[model samples]
Target: MKIRSVVLAAGLIGFSAVASASSFVGTTNAIGSILANTANALGDSTASTFGSDKVVLQAREDAASFVGSNGDLRGVNLEAALGHIRHQMPELQASDMQLAEAILAL
Candidate 1:
């Protein structure tokens, strides 16, 4: 009975972790879409007001600001940080969940 209880608890913990990761994925996707839209809008506005050259310059600056020395997203939560990070590092693996959790813990 004790063993069964332990197994059940472990299963529940796994399920909760999965659910949490799923929710984080959805939120991250939404945030990415929002950031893309914002960048697009900014580019459009800058191009319309200043000109194509200024928009190009702004894009270059943004790219530099988004990249980090380690080539990773320069923050605790990659998705949440978005434009603030020094690089564009997409969370592509399960290990990223650990990193995200660590960041949140801090």
Candidate 2:
């Protein structure tokens, strides 16, 4: 009977350790998911704040495509995008090169 009790206690402790490990894994996964979600939310908010207008969005797309294809900022698409941005936002203080670089950065 004493041997049986010892065996049972050992079995229970082993099960408890497994359960604790499983719980720790679950908690870590949940925290990782939360952090990823928070980062995504922040990224989306920053993008919206930076280029909320259709013109800016189109320009960024154009510049990105231009840069991707030509590997430089001398494409017609980039030029057109810069022109459109300057036309739309006359108050923008950035130079044409600066605007093109910003669009590429986006």
Candidate 3:
């Protein structure tokens, strides 16, 4: 009886994790789309505007990547993803550490 109860509890926890991840995936997708749309509306198609857009796009990409790949959100595991993100924008990644830290905290 104890074994059966433990199995049932584990199954319930698994189901809840799956449901929440599914919901967060949808939210991630929507946020990426909105960021792209905002970038398009910046009213300046010059190099600077394009550069600004690049930063926004990279952030969106990183957030989406995190949500999709983070089945396990333990601190050490996230370091690799953080490195992957730094490859996209070396300056931003080097200068600003808060973004990735905040993402992991979430």
lDDT, candidate 3, 1-106, per-residue tens: 9999999999999999999999999999998775454434331322242234434434444544554554333244345444544565455422123333334233
Among all candidates shown, the one with the greatest lDDT: 2
Give the least accurate 10-residue stretch of model 3, judged by summed lDDT.
Answer: 41-50
lDDT of 1 by residue, 28-98 (tens): 99976855565455444333433433323333422333342323544323544332221333432223333
The runs of at least 3 residues in candidate 1 whose Cα sits more than 4 Å from the true structure, single-residue gaps closed, are 48-51, 54-59, 62-106
Cα lDDT tens digits, model 2, 1-106, are 9999999999999999999999999999997685455435533533454466555566666655554554454556567766766676677666554555466444
lDDT of each: 0.45, 0.62, 0.49
Positional deviation of residue 39's Cα in model 1 after best superposition, in angstroms: 1.5
Could you tell me every candidate's TM-score relative to the true structure?
A: 0.48, 0.43, 0.40
**Model 2 spans with C-alpha error above 4 angstroms:** 47-106
lDDT of 1 at 20: 100
- Supply candidate 2's per-residue lDDT for 70: 49
Q: Judged by TM-score, which candidate is best?
A: 1
lDDT for position 86 in model 2: 65
